[model samples]
Target: MNFREFASKNVHRNIKAYFAYFFSSSISAALLFSFTMIIFHPDFVKVDLPQYLIKALNVTTIIAYLFLFFFVFYSVSVFLKSRYKEFGILYIIGASRKQIQRMISIENIIISSVSAIVGIIVGIVFSKILLAASGKLLGFNALGFYMPVKAMIITFVAFVMIGIVISIFCSFIIKEDMVLKLLKGTKKPKAEPKASSILVIICITLLTVGYYLSITSSTKTLTNRIIPVTLMVVVATYLLFSQLSVFTIKLLKKNRNLYMKKTTVLWVSNLLYKIKDNTRMFFLITITSTIALTSIGSVYAYWRDKEDQINRDFPQAFFLSDIYDNKSKVDSKAGFIEDSLINQGIEYNKINEELKFVIPDGGKDNVVIIKEDIYKKLISMLSLNANFSKEDESLISNHKVKNIVLDNVEIEVVLKSDRGLIPTFYGEVYVVKNDIYEKITGVRGYFGAFNVENYQDTLNICNDYYNNFGYEKEDKYHNNLLKSRILRSTKVAYGVILFSAIFIGLIFFVTTGSFLYNKCYMDVIEDKKKYRQLNKIGLTYKEIKRVLNIEIGVLFLLPYIIAVIHFFFAISSLRYAFKLEIKVAAFRVIVIMLIAQIIYFLIIKKRYLLEIKKSLI
Candidate 1:
């Protein structure tokens, strides 16, 4: 047979080993293609996305492509390693190295061609849904669907090139002298896997330190320590699976009652080698899954709490101020805004307060002072309760100071309110009696607060007022419309991040599952042989099945459970760092991930059982 035909037959015979690799490659291609289609869409420009957002999409697409290359490369290495015995037999039959290289090239080309074609088709099918979701999340007009010829060409070419490059690189990995080693393969008996006591202790220490730092570090320190903490956790996790797990398993083996029970002896004896062999795979899976969970959870938390954040920063729906002494300008702008609201048929309450900016005695910073009457009116307008009975005392709003000396008048701060009476731009407001305000000589300004029902729905009117009357020059008349716009834009940006995180997290999850499946597939021949021998020794089929269940369950769930533990600490640290109530969002993500893992486990377990059953027949 020709080399092409031989390669095709070999691929067909090893389809099980190739399936996960093909599936993951196709998925990676589809993700890239779908993202490219969004970037290249005809209406994308019309969406008016900010330049930074556009750049972010482009950068994310590039990163995805890079990830795809590494993912494909790793899968190819795994696939090649699993077929060492086959390669050895070909060597024994006198197949030249160059000829084997050509065979591998032909096989990869076939797989790549089919995967790219199928992936592009699937991407096209899902492009419209992705566009609609993006548009909705970004608050843009619905994106129209068109043939993505440029995207298709790019994705197909990229996938095929990646396959070819990786295949050639993998070909060079096999050496001439490795034929005997390849032939031995898994048949070479292994001594008991050993763990270094020092390494195990180091692993435990690193993990403890990492977890402690993650949980205890405040937001201020988190940024500086994040890199070191991540490195620590990553190295610790690697050693955790490589050394700690083996050590723990050995300790379990020493318990004769637990280790010697039922089919435990069979599975336990086999599990030691399995865990040792799969250490790196477990490490990769755990880290990848932890990243997926934490990213999705953190971003979702930000998106979920966006409204509360806006409300906290901006208490008033509309605030217009003239930092200069221009009462006429402030009144005119305030009247114009009130008229605009009336024109839009929106109900609102307005508070006009005169604020005096004075550098407090013995302090360099300016403190705003307003009268008691205005303070009462402002709090009532905002549905806040405050009592200021003494003229000598003051109420501090959104400030931590307990006393203020304005123009040498020592005013004790009787109450401190967290809620801002106005937008936070005018800092450190003190509510004093009219006598106290009149006694201070300082630069004065007019502040207007407009509280409207369903104010969020008034973006159009607010934008119109700003367009017609808002001044660009600073220190003249500043309005809160810009702040409102920023808040809306912030929400959109967070939505974009949250959506992207979910998408990338799913890709990571799927890749990790595929990795596990490939690992299981690699051991199928060995498992079948081992189980057949156990069956000859009067081990019943039921017992063998039980052992398989135990082994498969540990293989599939151990990494996931560890990843969840890692994720919990990560999310907890994020919560403390950001001071966000992210428990609900984190919990939701965990539940969804758990369900997906369970489904993946069931499917893989069934397939593995069928593969091993073939040996019995």
Candidate 2:
């Protein structure tokens, strides 16, 4: 047979071994292609995405491409390692090193080309669905699909280049002196896997410290400590698998009772070697899955709680603010707003207050002072309660300030409230009795807070009022309608972010599963031989199946369990940081990911058992 035919036949013969890698590569290509199509779509520009969002999309697309390169390279390296014996036999049969390289290059080319083409085809088929989903997430009505020639070309070229680059790199992996070791394969006895006691202690300490930091940190300190905590946990996780796991397995083996239990000896004996060999793989899977879970959970939580957050920040349907000197202008704008609400058949309560902006004694910042009557009226409208006994005693509406001294008139701050009576644009605000308010002298401003029924349904009227009066280069009047618009846009931005994160996170998740499957399948031949011997020793197929279940379950679930633990800590930290009630959203994401992992595990387990069962026949 010619060289091309031989290489093609090799691929066809080992299709089972190559399937996972090929499938993963195709998925990577498809995802990248889909992202590219979205980026280059005509409707994307029409949506007027924020500049940061556009930049984020570009950055994520680049990151995905880089990840694809590394994934392809890693898979190819593992494939070559698994075929070391095959390559060693070829060498004995007089196949030159140059000829083998050529064979590998040909095989990779075929795989890459087919994978790229198939991926593009899949991408094209799913383009409409992808576009529709993206549109809905971005708050656009439709992102019509057109011929994605550019996307196809880019994805095709990118994967093809990845294949070529990885194939060339694979040449260096097959070193000249490795032939002897390759031929020896599992025949060579391996020394007992060792772990450093000091490293194990460090790993435990790091994990403890990391978890403690994440769990105990308050919202104020979380940002400052998040990086250090993350680094600690990540390093600890790697050590946990690489050192702690091996060390623990050794300790377990020392317990004769546990180690010698029914079938425990079989799986336990194999597990030590497997864990030692797959330490890095387990680490990679844990870290990647942790990242995926955390990202999706955080984004999902934020998206779910966005509306409540908006309501907390903006309690009223409309707020009109103007300088004290522009009293007439403020009244005119307020009248126009009230008129617009009436025209829209909306019922509303208007609380008009004169606010005094004063700097406290020895303080550079301005504090807004409002009369007790106005404060009570505004709070009552919003269904909130507060009491003031004396004029000297003041309630600070702003959470940050404790007390205020204006013109040497000291006012005792009695209560701090989370609910802002006014838009946060006015820095610090205090509610005092009329007697105290009259004494404070500074720039006076007109502030109006309007509470309306079903404020969300008033966007049209709010827009109209804003366009007529508030929309100007030098317009000093500000309204809550603008805040609502901002909140809407913010939701869209977050939706885009959430969608992107989920896409990237799923890719990471799927890649990790494929990596595990590849690793498991690579060991099948050795497992077959080992199990064959066990079978001859009167180990029934049922017993063997039970042993395989334990082994494979550990291989699949260990990293996932570790990742889930990491995700719990991560979600906890997120809850503290944002102070949002996001447990429901986070729980939903975790359950979804858990279900997906279980499904993936079942599919892989079934396939693996079939492969092993082939040995019995």
Best by lDDT: 2
What does candidate 2's lDDT look like per residue over 466-534, in tens digits? Answer: 678655554324434445565767788888888788888878877787898788878887888888898
Error of 2 at 261 (Å): 1.1
Compute each candidate's TM-score over C-alphas.
Answer: 0.89, 0.91
Cα-based lDDT at residue 339, candidate 1:
90
Q: For candidate 1, lDDT tens digit of each residue in 4-28? A: 8899998899888899888877887
Model 2: pairs clashing at backbone N, Cα or C within 3 Å: none
**TM-score, model 1 to reference:** 0.89
Using TM-score as the measure, the top candidate is 2
Off by over 4 Å in 2: 92-96, 186-188, 320-336, 356-368, 389-392, 398-411, 424-428, 438-445, 462-481
Poorest 10 consecutive residues of model 1 by lDDT? 475-484
